[model samples]
Target chain A: MRGSKAVVGVYSYLDDLLKGIADIRSADLDYKVYSPAYRHEIEEATLPGKSSVRRFTLTGGIIGCTFGWTLAILCSLDWPLRVSAKDIVSPPGFFVIGYECTILFGALATLGSLLLYCGLPNFLRKVGYDPRFSRDKFGLVVGCDGHNLEDVKGRLMKSGADEVNVTEGI
Target chain B: MSKQSEKKEVSYAMVNDLVLRMLEPPGAGWWVLLLTCITLLSWGAVSFAYQLWAGYGMAGNAHPIGWGTYITNFVFWVGIAHSGTLISAVLYLFRAKFRMPIYRLAEAMTVFAVMTAGLFPLIHVGRPWMALWLMPYPNERALWPNFRSPLLWDVFAVSTYFTVSAVFFFVGLVPDIAAARDRAKTFFRKMLYGVASLGWTGNNTQWKHFIAAYLLFAGLATPLVVSVHSVVSWDFAMSIVPGWHATIFPPYFVAGAIFSGVAMVMTLIIPLRKVFKLEPLIREEHFDAMSKLILLTSSIVAYAYITEFYVAWYSNNMFERFQFWFRPFGEFAVAFWGMAFCNCIAPLALWYGPLRRNIAFLFVLSIIINIGMWLERFNIIFTSLAREYIPAAWGSYNFSWVEIGITFGAFGWFGMWMTLFIKFFPAVAITEIKEILPPPVRNKESLQGHH
Candidate 1:
């Protein structure tokens, strides 16, 4: 293990390439996980061990709906107009607004919540390199600047990664 | 994926029998075709023609009660429509699996209910020809529509809701339409589902795009539904009559909408599910889950009812105070308590888990809820107005037979739409149900070697 920086073009790996790498304290390995149109790597490196940005719970959706409804109601109160001889604050009359607000607020809030939580941008940019990953291959690309780059690559090969590749990021 | 598939066993046969039953000719329960729906529907329409030819007097508009039975039915129908979106988009987004059997039909209900609702305002208008004024158009008249007007809001809310839900419903139906497309041998059927499916091929890419678009529409629509009903609630809440003004009306009305809607869905779906042999697919489990929701919504509505009365009492305002007290003890006390029995008291039947699970009990409860929701609307609209701001303006609202005709006509319109949908499309989304089936039940033989 020696050197400042190096990139290994990991075309493929044996199933047990890292099975024999033993008695090492630790290694600093920077892995970038990418998937093509069809399949992406499992992205173990990117997944937060403690906390994650990607969440699918509906609580966020519900809160957003409720909040949106509350906001719409808050906005509607600006001018409580009289209609057809009835006072503006009647509870039965508010039924229409409440109903409308609930539907609008709940639905819009859910949409807004989903967009925020899903981490979706206007566009998904594509990164190049990795053909076998398209056909059920988990690509593990490790960027390291030490003499043990090969050793790190070897470790991933043993961790059930069918192919290992080093690709340039956009 | 394999483990997920292995997690639960769902005998597809449980639902298969339903499809097979639907495939069979409907049995000898001809009363549904003759006496109940058809008779009621035509009777209503024929009555409506007379209403239009004559005047608003047939339905008992009288002098004080400008709005009568038609408005009550309008609000009632609007309330009845909430469960469709609640089940299809809202519950689906929440991943409530029990919603599967009822989603399509519920969505159909939303569309039909809105259709029926849109009719009443027109019928109630003195000059139906002027209904075009409801539209925001660049006409010669410089007058602007009062945006603050809840009636205008209904125009926006109901139209938006109906349009969006129809799209959402159709989008979800695409895959099923594709399935129907594949299964269909006839020219018209193939053309119908083909165009409806929008050239869908079950490629993963297509499915992804279709799902994404459908999700987007659902997200867009979920709010419109809340907005629609909140607007409806606001129509009442914005009024200053004794019982009409309260802050809780929005949430309370929404709860009632969902409560009543779910009940209506239950009423229609239970019969359809049974007749179509869908008991296995719709399942006791689904009914159990729905019963719990019925209980929850019922509780919220009941809470709203109490909160309303409490606020009226605490406010100590004579007008508001008189509204609540007079409602229970006045000449209309029988009707007031009747509303309570239908909306509030009867739902307690769901408190027992066994009763909630009982299809017959739930069926009866569903009927009661509908009856109660209708009365609740009647009480809200008529009770407050029957006794006017001045004792001189005080007068009772009564529905003449002509008024009754338009009311029933509205129901006929709703049922006709539903009947048409059933004749054309499969009521259940077969593929979606298959997707949600627990793995073992999905692949019945997949568990042989697992120790």
Candidate 2:
């Protein structure tokens, strides 16, 4: 992966980092933020749209419930036992299996969506990632062509970035 | 870059260092604990092998008391598993910030306890190879497991619980694993942490999806906390046996489960906090909050007991009344009273602030509660079955050496897994603690409009 962005600013304080990102945003410079922790401020600033993971959860739950009911009812019909003079299609017993499957499938779907949305299991590490981004430092990777590289770096530095490193790609 | 004019009191850098330090290789004491657990676990494996060779007859189970110590231990461990989901998932949904430090351990306990609990039914069945028949797969024999049986429901419930809990535990560990990956000093360590972390970058987009998925899991697991134990309870309640067939069993079992589970967590965290020196993260305030939860659950369990006895008397059923009466005054009366005293009377100590805060007192009390909870299952299973409808078929069961060894082995199994987990994974949620800490103050001029 070639890094097109030149400036990577690390900040000790989240507010300073957010301010720096906001200043860069004003210049319409494309950037991505990284933090050691999940900060609501960062999410609100960078990715404000609603997540789509819940749709997968709902779809998975529906399929699970239907499958559970179908399996129970079909298995009983196949056996065709007249135990205790009760109906072969026992809704009560089927509901238990269905309830469990709903949770099982819903949880699995959530995991699937998490992996898909997060772009995980990428054996190859992305380029231009700072090690300290996973520790205390919050990093803002700004994308800039050579014409605006110095301009973006100066803005982040003036916005109180602890360190500003100019990388070639991203 | 120029340094800030004033020094920041605390920084995320310090938090990362303290939390990640726990993931280092074990000390001498941890190794000793692991070896002891492994030895005990090996003894348990030997006992299981013997049981396999000797058949179910080797267990103390007999005609009337068909279910014995194995089932008792099964129920106890299942109950012990509940508090983890309760603390991790349920408490998370409720927005309990205090759960941050200890929830990971509780979730780990849930997974391990369920794994241990899964072994019991197979062990109890004697024919371990035939246990595969419990699965719902299509077979050439044209036979299906009895869906009407709560036992079958248990097969589904417990397995689902294990899967969900394990996934939840791993999902929560991702950021921590990434943190570990960054700090890895060796190539082997980096590669291991790298795979475990799955290339987590902690970017804004990933956090958005991560939080969403995590919340969904919390929501999914919360129902499981209620349904799994309720299903376990139905294994008894759905039966025709006196003292077992009660509508109240679901809530009763659920409360008892949380009661025992919380005690187990206390038992674990007290020793862990001391050994790991995690006082700042797992403070006295956390214990105070947890003890109060224990008190609440204990009271519920106590109320369930009284209501159970009252219902037995009011029903005017001779068998039910006898079963209830026999519990406190019959052959298992000692166990019955011990259970009541330990589960109901012992947790009352937490109501006092001094006792709740007293580490030694709480630790001992937690152990006592575990014992009581175990006895509670024993009394419930044995007394009712021994003196059932047929007096001629009445019999008593003694815990044979096999069952005793297996029980000890289960503990060893749980302990060994946990010992390794603490050494490898972040014992506490490092990413979460960073979020919980107040962010550093910034200059008003630079941050004025953003806030």
Instruction: Name the top lDDT candidate.
Output: 2
Model 1 spans with C-alpha error above 4 angstroms: A1-170, B1-36, B438-451
Cα RMSD for candidate 2? 3.2
Model 2 chain B — which ten-residue stretch has the worst lDDT? Answer: B1-10
Give all candidates' CA lDDT scores.
0.63, 0.88
Residue B95 error for model 1, in Å? 1.4
- lDDT by residue (tens digit), candidate 1, B292-356: 88889989988888887899889988777777877788767877788788887888877787887
Task: Tell me the deviation in Å of residue B437 in model 1.
Answer: 1.8
TM for every model, in the order presented, reads 0.71, 0.96
TM-score for chain B in model 1: 0.91
The positional error of residue A87 in candidate 1, measured at the CA in angstroms, is: 18
Candidates in order, interface RMSD in Å: 10.8, 1.5
Question: Any idea what lDDT model 2 has?
Answer: 0.88
TM-score of the A-chain for all models: 0.45, 0.93
RMSD of every candidate to native, in Å, equals: 10.6, 3.2
In model 2, pairs of residues that clash are A3-A169, A3-A170, A4-A169, A4-A170, A5-A169
Query: Which tens-of-lDDT digit does each residue in B233-339 have in candidate 2?
Result: 99999988999999999999999999999999999989998887777677777888889999999999999999999999999999999999899999889999999
